[model samples]
Target: MKAIITVLGRDKPGIIFHVSEILYKVNANIVDLDQTVLEDKFFSMILVADIDEINCDYNDLKDKMDQLGKKINLQIKVQQEDIFNAMYSV
Candidate 1:
């Protein structure tokens, strides 16, 4: 399945690396990624990751983000592409 993952939390070093590395380790291909920093917060949205072959299906992706959440107290969510699209339509 394909989707967009958003990470939002306090600004700090290595946040991108930490997140991206997990994606890489899971064999997810990042087709597009855009990130920015504003004040003391960091925000990122990533698209085009191929997670079909990933173990544990899509839940593994969630777990990876969850781990990061515990480590940095960040909010991370991975959504199905259709769900995300529908949300924007409303």
Candidate 2:
């Protein structure tokens, strides 16, 4: 399975570290990632990860990411690749 992860919020330190930590714990291998800070204050990131061998259920991973986002004051979202594509298809 593949997943799309997005992170957005005021720029801050350790955002990537914390987000990647959760993925690491769940054994989600990151296949691609893009991140940038706009005007040096807003942060945005999109990551594609391979979750076929994750250690926990998909919902569990989502919850973990949510919790981490709350703790870090960022808006983090995880979506199944197929659903994400379907929703955004032209």
Per-candidate count of clashing residue pairs (backbone under 3 Å):
0, 0
Query: Which ranges of candidate 1 are over 4 A from the true structure?
Result: 40-48
Pairs in clash, predicted candidate 2: none
Error of 2 at 15 (Å): 0.6
lDDT of 1 by residue, 1-90 (tens): 676788887777887788788888888877777777776565554545767766556877788789887898878788778886787786
TM-score of each: 0.81, 0.93
Give the root-mean-square deviation of each candidate in angstroms.
2.2, 1.2
Alpha carbon lDDT at 60, candidate 1: 73
Residue-level lDDT for 23 in candidate 1: 84
lDDT of 2: 0.94
For candidate 1, the C-alpha RMSD (Å) to the true structure equals 2.2
Those runs of model 2 whose alpha carbons end farther than 4 Å from true positions after fitting are 88-90
Error of 2 at 12 (Å): 0.6
**Model 1, backbone clash pairs (residues 3+ apart or across chains), number:** 0
